[model samples]
Each structure stands twice: as structure tokens, then as C-alpha cells.
Target: MINGDFNGDGNLDIVVANEDDGYLAILLGNGNGTFTGPFYSAPIFSYQISIYAADFNADNVLDLAIASSDTYTLVISLGSGNGNFEDPTFLSPENYYSANFAIGNFDTDTIL
Candidate 1:
């Protein structure tokens, strides 16, 4: 699971990878110790393991990077800044050691 202010609402929201179901579920925070949702992403048909949240497109909105072990793939879900995400964009890593990754401005060039 991962948590952040996904909707720019200043409240912490959550994202969970459903390993058994091959999808990601989001829970939007209400800021009063409560949350709502379980908003789902499209199925990946693989065993999901790790998830990373960041603004991958430099859009200032938090986005998602989901890793699946069973299929050896990584998927991107761009956020709409309103607790909603676009469809997943699938990627195949040639020699990934595990179903996990880190997000950062690896090149130190103001982008990720």
C-alpha cells in the first residue's frame, strides 16, 4: 500500500495492489480520519506486488507505477488530480530483478 495527497486535497489517500485480483485499488481520504473509495484500475492479469506514486508526467498530479511479478511488467497510471486515474500503460522490463522499482529524477534534470 502507498499513501499520499493524491487529489491535491491536502488529505492522505491510499493505493493498494490487489495481488490476487491483478488490479490496483485507491482509497481517497476525507481528512477527518475517514476515507472513501476502492476505486479500481484495469486488470493486469498478473500477480501484482509493488506500487510507486509520483508525478511522472511533470503535471504536478500524483501518478502510479505498478509492478507485477508474474508477468514481469510495469504499468503506469496517470492521475487526474481528482482521485481518478487514466488507463494503465504497460511496460516490459528486459532484466528486472524483482517486481519493484524506485521513482526519481535519475538524471537530475528536473524530470522523472
Candidate 2:
């Protein structure tokens, strides 16, 4: 699970990889120690899936990046900054069984 102000609403929110259900779910916080939603992403159909969050498109909205070992691919879910995300973009990494990945400016290009 990961937490951040995903909706730009100044409230903490959560995103979790639901391996059992094959989806990524989000829980939006209400700022009063309560949360709502299990807003789900598309089914990943993988047994082992991991997730990370960031503004991958430089749009200042937090997005999600998921790695699925069963599918041997990384999926990107660009956020709409309103607690919702766009469709995923899949990429094939050199390591087919990559269980996790790092998001950063590895090339010093100021991009993720």
C-alpha cells in the first residue's frame, strides 16, 4: 500500500495492489481519519503484482506503475488527479520476472 494526496484535495489517500482480486484499488481519505473507496483499476490477471506511485507524466498528478510477474510486463496507470486513473500502458522489461521496479531520474533527465 502507498499513501499520498492523490486527488490534490489535501487529504491523505491510499492505493493498494489487490493480488487476490487482480486489481489495484484506491481508498480516498476524508481528512477526519476516515476513508472511502476501493476504486479499482482494470484486472491485471497476475498472481504476483506490485505497485508504486508517482507523477510519471510530469503532469503533477500522481500515477501508478505496476509490475506483474505472471504477465512479464510493467503497467502504467496515469492519474487524472481526481482520485481516478487512465487506462494502463504496458511495457516489456528486459527482466521478464521482475517483481519490482524503481521510479526515478536514472538518466538525470529530470523525468521518471
Candidate 3:
């Protein structure tokens, strides 16, 4: 599970990795300690082990970074600033299986 203000709504939201179902579940918050989702699903295949959130494109909207151990792919799903995500951008890394990642401006150039 990953938590962030993905919708730019000022409330914390949750995105859960569901490997068995091959999708991610989004739970949007109501700011009153109540949540209102599992509203959308982002489809993916194989076993997903890790998920992270950040504004990968510098759009100020939180996007998802998913690592799939079984599929050996890194997926970047850009957010729409309204609790929705676009279709993922897929990447194949040589040693992706069972892999994990950290998101940051690694080069200090303000890019993630």
C-alpha cells in the first residue's frame, strides 16, 4: 500500500497493490477520517511486490511507480490531478525480478 495526496485534494489517499487480481485499488479520502474508494483499478499482470508514489513528470500530481517481480517491469502511471491515472508507461530493466526501488532526485537535478 502507498499513501499520498494523489488527487490534489489535501487529504491522504491510498493505493493498494493487488497482485492476485492484477490491479491496483485506489482509495480516496474524505478528510474526515473516512475513505471513499477502491473506486478505480489500474491493470497489471504478474506478481507486484512494491508500489511508490511521486510526481514523476513534475506535474505536481502524485503518480504511481510500480515494480513487478514476476513481470520484470517497472511501470509509471501518471496522475490526472483528479484521482485518476493514465495508462502506464512500461520499462524493462535487466534485473527487475523481486526488485524494489526508491524515488527521489537522485542526481539532485529536481527530477524523479
Candidate 4:
């Protein structure tokens, strides 16, 4: 998990992706400073990707970026205020997949 907070709220969220399952899960940031995930399961028909966490939408709530060998996709889930996240997949750009991904606001728009 990138920016792993370990409690999953909305202020310290983390981003994690798997390639074989093509699954990208976000760990929400709890205001108290912790991240929680396991929000989704690995799909049966896909490759796992490397994921990174950041607030791509600049919503203050953390967003996720899943990196594939072909591209990097964004999944910004809405926070339930309880460390739970739901669908909000936003495709970003073509990025090469690596065993690990870097997290941060490389564009100075969010956090890692």
C-alpha cells in the first residue's frame, strides 16, 4: 500500500493494486491518522497491478492510481466516513507497470 495509514478513514488513505486481478483497491485515511483496506477482492480474470495512493481529485480525501504495464488508471472512491470506499474509477494516463509504484502529488495537487 502506498501512503499506508493502516486505519482507513479518509485523511490518510493508501493505494494498492494487483496486476493478476487487475484490481485496484484504496485504503481510506482516518482523520486520526490511520489507513484501512481489503476494500476489494482480487478478480478472477485479470493481472494484479502496482498501486499508489494520493488525492488525484483534490477532494482532500485520498485517491488511488493503479499502474498496469500498459497504463495507469485512477480510482477515487467516495468516503463513507467510516473507512469504507465505493466505485469511482477515473482513468489517468498510460503508465508502465512496476512491482511497486510511487505515491505523491508529483503535480503538486495532492498527497502520496
Candidate 5:
């Protein structure tokens, strides 16, 4: 589950992982006591554990970091700002950590 305001626009988006077909659901914020989403017409993601969103590149724009502990893999997605996102330009495949990683800036702008 991705409970984050990745856009930095102040509306939290929730992305629920459908483990059946490996798809991600992006629930948009209505900004008025309601959230309307699950805007998935097709399937996305393939076997994932947990999804985290943050500024992984220090670009001030929030991005997504998806972890697959079952596969010992950690994947990341860079935000596109138009309600969609993409993967990182540079990947750290060697860093195969668990999906449910605890992330917070410990004074170095890092999400680990």
C-alpha cells in the first residue's frame, strides 16, 4: 500500500497492490473529504510486496520505491507529475532488500 503525497501537491494518493495479476492501483485525492481512485483499466506491477513514495533523487519531486522481498529485489519509480509514474533511470539491482522498508530522512535526504 502506497499512502503518500508523492506529487507534493498536498493530496495523498493510495496505491493498492493487487497480488493476483501484479497490478498497482492509484487512488486520487478529491481534496474534499473523499478519495476517488482504483483508476486501473489494465494491470501494472508483477509480484511486489510494499510500495513507498518519496524524493529518492533529491529533485524535490516525490517518487516511488517498490520492494519485492520475496524476490529480494527493490524497484523504484520516478514520478511524472501527471498522475502517473515511471521507473528509475539508474537502478540498484544489487540492493535487494525487503519490500516493507522503513523510510525517513535522517538528515541526509535518504529513503532506506
Candidate 6:
């Protein structure tokens, strides 16, 4: 699971990578410690193991980057400002597995 203010709602929300179901589930928070969701993403054939949240596109909206082991790919799902995501952009590594990810200005270019 990963947590962030994905909708810019000032409340902590959660995104769970469900490998068993081959989907991602989003749970939006109400700020009072309550949540609402299970809003799912399209099926992915790999086992999603880690999730990171950041503004990957520099669009100011939080996006999700998921690492999957089976496909050895990093899938980026851009947020739509309403706790929803667009179709994922798939990136495959030369290696055969990806288990984790981190976001930052790794190149000192002010981008992640």
C-alpha cells in the first residue's frame, strides 16, 4: 500500500497494489480517519509489489508509479484530480524484475 494526497483533497488517501486480483485499489480518505474505495485499475498480469506517489509529469497532481516483479516493468498511472487514474504507461527494464522504486530529483534536474 501507498499513501498520499492523490486528489489534492488535503486528506491522506491509500492506493493498494493487489497482485492476487491483478489490479490496484484506491481508497480516498474523508480526513476524519474514514475512507471510501476499492476503486480499481485495469488488470495487470504481473505481481505488483511496490508503489510510489509523486508528481511524475510536473503537472502538480500526484501520480502513482508501480513496480511489478513478473513483468519487470514500472507502470505509471497519472492522476485525474478526482482520485482516479488514466491508463498506465508501461516501462520495462533490461533486467527481469522490479521490486521497489523511489522518486526524487535524482539527476539534480528538478524532476523525478
* Tens digit per residue, CA lDDT, model 4, 12-88: 55555555456555556556655445576333124434555455555565444454444444344443334444555
- Give the per-residue Cα lDDT of candidate 6 at 5: 88
Candidate 3's C-alpha lDDT?
0.85
In terms of lDDT, model 1 sits at: 0.85
Candidate 2: segments with Cα more than 4 A from true spot = 93-95
Per-candidate clash tally: 0, 0, 0, 26, 0, 0
Winner on lDDT between 2 and 5 is 2
Q: Put down candidate 3 lDDT per residue, 1-112, tens digits, no spaces.
A: 9999988889999998888877888899999999997775657765788899988998789998899888888888999998888999888666657458778888999898
Give the clashing pairs for model 6: none
Q: In candidate 4, where is summed lDDT lowest over 10 consecutive residues?
A: 41-50
Residue-level lDDT of model 5, residues 10-110, one tens digit each, is 88777776767766778877778688766652444467777777777676666777666555666677776656677434243665566567678778745
TM-score per prediction, in order, is 0.89, 0.90, 0.91, 0.45, 0.69, 0.91
Residue 84 C-alpha lDDT in model 5: 69
RMSD in angstroms, all models?
1.6, 1.6, 1.5, 5.8, 3.5, 1.4
How does each model score on lDDT? 0.85, 0.84, 0.85, 0.49, 0.66, 0.85
- Cα-lDDT of candidate 5: 0.66
CA lDDT, candidate 2, residue 43: 80
Cα lDDT tens digits for candidate 2, 1-112: 8888899999999998877877778899999999998788788656646788898999999998888787788888899999988888878666688677888889999999
After superposing candidate 5, which stretches have Cα over 4 Å from the reference?
Answer: 41-45, 88-97, 104-112
Q: Estimate, for each residue in 1-112, the C-alpha lDDT of model 6 and write its tens digit.
A: 9899887889999998888877888899999999997688887645888888889898999998888887788888999878999999888666767787677897999888
Candidate 4 clashes: the total is: 26
